[model samples]
Target: MSEKDTETVVHRLSTIRERLDAGMDRREFVRTLASAGYAVGMAQLLGVDDFLETDDGDVPVVTALARDRTDDPFSLEKRTRTVPAEWYAAVEKAFEVNEILASSRVMGYLGSAVVPGDYRSGTASVTIGVTGDSGFIGDLIGTVSDSLGLEIERFEDEEFETFEEFRDGADRSIRQPRLARDAANGTAPGGVTCETDSTMATLGPAMYDPESGSSFFVTAEHAFDDEATVVGEALTLPTETEESFDLGTVRFDHPIADIVAVEPSGRLDPINRIDTSPPSTITGQYTRWGLADLLARGEPLEKVGAMTGHTTGEIQGIDAVTCFTDNFCRHGQIRWGSEMDLIDGDSGSVSYHPDPEDPEESVLVAGFNNARTWWPGQSYVWGVSAYRVNESLGYHF
Candidate 1:
């Protein structure tokens, strides 16, 4: 080729390189290369280094937390693993799209959740629930989906129950546990009955506040009356065999998330273990992407409510936003199991899954099971996810 022709070719290649460096979509990059007279295979080869840094053919992500020492509640560490780059990109884009939809609060929007596609498909979709079917609403969602290259599944005319309705139907009939003080460990295991003056709820797994370097006994804030926090109502641990003892006072109350942290004032400190047939130790909690991975793998979450004992159910959705029950929307919620898996007194019980790293003895908390759908057409238990709690309150399990 002549020098001028060669210079022209170099200019085209340079422009393509600049666009690639500017983070162009991989598919768009390939299309641009095709337009520039390059084969799709060659385009992929050229962009391989820009897309993913593959180790054994996968990309790395920090999925969950793990404790350096089992006994040390504060010794938390992040766990990472390489995942398929395509799947990662899909999930990441789905999260972004879901956030946009949530922030916009589209007309007729009730709530929505992200469903990550399988590794082979390399896709993700947002499942949104709305109160009515409207053409404009559909068109708006369609336009957003088209522009972002994401799928959206819409559900219309779904009914939702309020917190008051759930509280009114509370069952106080379940037999309470007789917990023995663990003087040897100097900490209390969760999955037992804890009470405010007016109501009772299941004690959740211990939560660690990294900022304060403090561990707290967490439970559903709605279990107490609205004035409980204002009146300095004490939290009590009731035993079947012995007199009930004061566990602590409410340290922090989050009404919207329906969670509260109790400052331990008694001898027993909150530990990371749950009371089960073979006790399950909470090693850490899952991240949003980690929960999505579980959903894609068809994994079930297990919880030990004070009333229901031990029950397991499949995860329905992740990174969900729910606005039906309250005046404001609650984001980063997980919908799982079924309504039967949770009951009135089951509030504050934690939904968890066995740790992927050590499934036999340790587990990772998915979220707090504070409420379940009481309306028809939907049968899943819903609550604030562990990732949301960590992000909002700076607490981790």
Candidate 2:
């Protein structure tokens, strides 16, 4: 390109950057780039590579989608925060590298996750789980690490139970009801028992579908044997008073993510709260970068499962892709807590943290607790992240 054309491109990018700095969202920025005839490698053109060396300033990043009105489920507002430019850049690069590794689908690759270092380090790494050490895998990792100046950690893959095996051994018997009803809200909060045709799982927090303007009661999709059979099946919520009532019918079933959204069918509605000793209201969900920030700070995540009640543990990995427990890979997962934190009946429970903005009354959802590692070498609960669920299915807590 000529100097004049290069100047024109730079000028356009400057204007776009100004808009972004003024609070333009990611989707809008992408649309703007598309309209400007920018190709797939737009990041290069935008000078994102310079972020590594340019370390003086901070960059604005959207962290969460929070409720503007506590009572209104649809009043979602984007939450943004400014972070050290170097840390942001490193995390972005790590995410890109992680995607590359996942897409490669190298031999014996079981799963991988991106782990961002602290602000002081200004670095990130990808931790990979493989069947065993191989020359090809080592060479690929070395090549990528050398090229990008990124770290790659490898571990031997341990035996993990498939969904079928896990579900088969799970205790299907309904436990004594301990539902904590919020009489004022007239809603059923999560962290309580919900029944499917063959098994029972903990209900997830209330989720909002923006397109349909509807709220749903969510749980593990794998709670039922087949999606076809779940169509007309009713999801029943059992209360502490030994009363069982129909909550709704399955509105959406996503097998890959192992989540299901149930449309309400009765007077009681699903609320954005967990039925714990002191209930935690769902305020919003963290972004992928937000989760990385938590990891850098050594913050831990908490969950209230039907079987195990409440438990807490450290954040292990983010933006993970696991191909171990299923035939197809599950992408965009958050592995946190511990194997003991999650059990059979905890399949549909959610893992969350106290909302940074309002720690007392509200909490931010990290993801769903769908499965746990039962192997001897490793131990941690893994599940589909809330950000992934929103990105894939357009649902938010």
Candidate 3:
């Protein structure tokens, strides 16, 4: 409390503040200052704890706390590269991580394609990103390299290190139509009519079980709004009434699926909905397909809402702010694109990835096609995975 004592305390407190900024631990630095005649309590009152205990969890958190200064310990060097083989290796790893391809799938990453990397002496360099303590990223890299027989190089601890995007995709393909779309497009020929407007532009597909021995089918939640008004062939019949029957309104809808089921109001016939078949090869020079199959880079995959039917596309990235939007959005959404072009009636349309097992033939209904992002040509979808969809719906994949 004496004048000399107060002056001594102020000087020591100032020295502790400077050391804390220089990466000195708080408790030790405070003790050192206190031993040197500074009042530790007064230093604490100067908001020292607030300055030291900054959180560095998420990318935004790290970016916000990381100041741009000559004194920063780590350096962020700029670079770029065109390593096709390396990029392919990264993609193969991502596919294995998502279980799309087996760990032993062939490496299709031959031939150099354009890519972005950090440049060093005209050699494109991609920094090996640091995974921090999780070690999950390290495992992912090893899995990819092992599967492709390649080694990743130049790893660095960058702000966002992982190469995996939200989803995956390849070239454009034919505007194939589902049975529902065939019906919508007036090509259902013998397919029974569901008087209900089943244009599910926003909903994802759910499995359907019909009466009268109809094969299993899938459709969207918004496809059948009202069962009472539907004029489809009914399952229950009377002697005086005709053969086909009308399926009733859907009983339940999976929270995450874009599909729903309806009890027929009249006689039932198979093929009410489209066939849920898988493809053979999803990429490179095909028939009944378009450039949609040539979409390996951009979006890993996407689903198209064509006038003929629901088709799949590779989703390169979401254009919206998806990671932390309100209840209206999900995480890691890249908001904006021109690729997800479906009509108003296509709400429950099924968006998904092509099945790798039968790439050109089989498909996985990932979700319902959603809105566009800030960038044109990108689209969004939402559906429960096989793990969750079956658990809640009392069904198995």
Better-scoring candidate (TM-score), 2 or 3: 2
**Which model, 1 or 2, shows the larger TM-score?**
2
How far is 227's C-alpha from truth in model 3 (Å)? 13
- Highest lDDT: give the candidate number: 2
For model 1, how does the per-residue alpha-carbon lDDT over 62-135 read when each residue is reduced to its tens digit? 87877889887778888887678767666665675566557655566677888877777767777776665434
Q: What is the lDDT of candidate 1?
A: 0.76
lDDT of 1 at 296: 74
lDDT of each: 0.76, 0.78, 0.31
How many residue pairs clash in all the candidates, one count each?
1, 0, 113
Lowest lDDT 10-residue stretch of candidate 3: 58-67
Point out the higher-scoring one by lDDT: 2 or 3: 2
Q: How large is the C-alpha RMSD of every model relative to the true structure?
A: 9.4, 7.9, 20.7
Cα lDDT of model 2 by residue, 1-397, tens digit: 2345434544665776577668866668678768966543344334444422354688788888888998887888988888887777667766765675676656677778888788788777777776665345445444334434443445554355556776568555655544645334468899988888788899998999989989999999888876454665678887766677788898777889998889999667988999887789999899887888889888999998888888999998999998877678999999997777877778899999899889997999999999987555668999999999999999999
Alpha-carbon runs more than 4 Å astray in model 3:
1-218, 222-245, 255-258, 264-266, 269-312, 317-339, 370-388, 391-397
